[model samples]
Target: MRPFAFERAPDLAAAQRVVALSASSRAETVPAMLLAGGTTLLDLMKLDVLRPERVVDINALAGRFGGVAAEPAGLRLGALARMAQVADDAGVRRDYPVIAESLALAASAQLRNMASLGGNVLQRTRCSYFRDVSHAACNKRNPGSGCAALGGCNRQHAVLGTSDHCIATYPGDFAQALVALDAVVEIEGPQGARRLPFAGLHRLPGDRPDEETVLRPGEIIAGFLVPAGPWARRSRYVKVRDRESYAFAAASAAVALDLDGDRVREARIALGGVATIPWRAREAEAALAGQVLDEAGAERAAAAAFREARTHGDNDHKPELGRRTLVRALLEAARMEI
Candidate 1:
């Protein structure tokens, strides 16, 4: 890792001040970064993909930030709460199966124990071009330089939210669940706290792939709030990866369905591993609403979900695979005992 100064933040305010003071004029570059799990941040730093001048440890504030509360109103998950803790919580497993399943299926037991919910959502792409300094052309790493994955080995790249500049897929399962459940993100910055829709947290790689999330400099993710809904209970997350363990998804779907007998009252679908961001398939949901929760309806919804998918040569099969994954997830969710 590169040489850097470190400090343990005693409180939220102290952490914010350190980052805010070191903030760069560019949104993509922050001189100081807050550390929670250090799962993603440390990895990037060692790879020389991220070179922060200072690292602020925020675990000292975990006493106030790490919490998992489930009430009739909704589910509130603190930013510092470990992935394993939230995934193993009885209320999360029972009431928000999709959320729990996503976390359970991610990384390994050790990573789950260390990774925090806030850091997980903000995790960067696993694109080889971006990670390796040898690859001289990675728009995500060095903006406007070029995108090596655009025509190179791009089977793992995105299809749903591709742009001329970049196609690196967002590689997190939890973000998809949050998007599907319409969770709200609580952000604490130097200005104070504010809430934003989870779906809006990530930005598409339109022309500037370097500018990923909508978070400002010195901003820290405080928590997540998922409202209680009938669809939340009857939800499932299906991930298809190259391997059974410690592998990233090739195509995955998070499905939440609210049904009335055999008919669908509502459907919420968020796609992962095939998009630049946690993709919410509103068109797919529209197709399934008021329709019978059957194979035919699922097929139609799946088609709608990938209608706008644009794939390069190596990843041409992603759209079809994504469609099948969604179909399978919807069918499996329909059969859930909940």
Candidate 2:
């Protein structure tokens, strides 16, 4: 809303140079956040949450920067790839079913068409305290001031990987599915282009809830690399909300199972709406390995995943919801053939 300069970038190199030249003097070099469809950024700016000095539009790089490729090696999704494109793509709906389902389950049709893959992955949590200017005590929005969610009405706060300083949940469905599949992100910056496993891309809030991702100041996400794995073909993303119509997940699970004659050969599980970040449930996978996929087995696995969950008052029901969501997701995934 405030006065800020805007420029449409011609290419990645030009975009990179524009960012470097504009932001080099700042302590952290990226002067302007690359603007895609501006769904998240613009929303924040309107709310006065984020007021970047400049806006760099990558509209011209659409064709050259966005596409989804299905290969023997894996799936490659360009950074500028639109959410609707990936969500509705036949390859995504057929092969990476969980990914498609997750995308379809988020926001709305218009926002999905406008939002980009990279922007969605980097979107911040939707904590109420962090959004309102009156509640500037939020540690995520303003560090060391105080945490409003600590004792405030926080039913949607995180249950896992939470510190006293912060407990805001990572509000993304697609990231959960991708992390479940062990997806990797390709990034380019001042140093050069490189790849990072999805698990390494996110960071725990720790004491500094201000910092979220591992991305440097001037870095840009290039693409997402999904390894051709057993779970990619047999996966399900299940979300549970209060009303179930364009609502954020109260508890969700992204589950992929490889079953062998009623026994689990392998499984990949990640939980959202219950963690500080996209939570990969290695414990749940371990519990399912070599075990059956019956109701009892699913319950056991779900319980294992939430075994270490430390929840607070008013939202203690999340652990139970997380367990039920996982159990249901596992059953749905087990039923899927190919």
Top candidate, metric lDDT: 1
- The TM-scores of all predictions, comma-separated, are 0.97, 0.95
Query: On residues 244-328, what C-alpha lDDT tens digit does candidate 1 reach at each position?
Result: 9899999999999999998999999999999999999999999999999899999999999999999989999999999999999
Candidate lDDT (C-alpha), each: 0.93, 0.87
Model 2 agreement with the true structure over 262-297: per-residue lDDT tens digits? 899999999999999999999999999999889999
**Runs of candidate 2 exceeding 4 Å displacement:** 17-31
Q: Candidate 1's error at 294, in angstroms?
A: 0.7
| TM-score attained by model 2 | 0.95
Top-scoring candidate (TM-score): 1
Please identify model 1 stretches exceeding 4 Å from their true place.
25-30
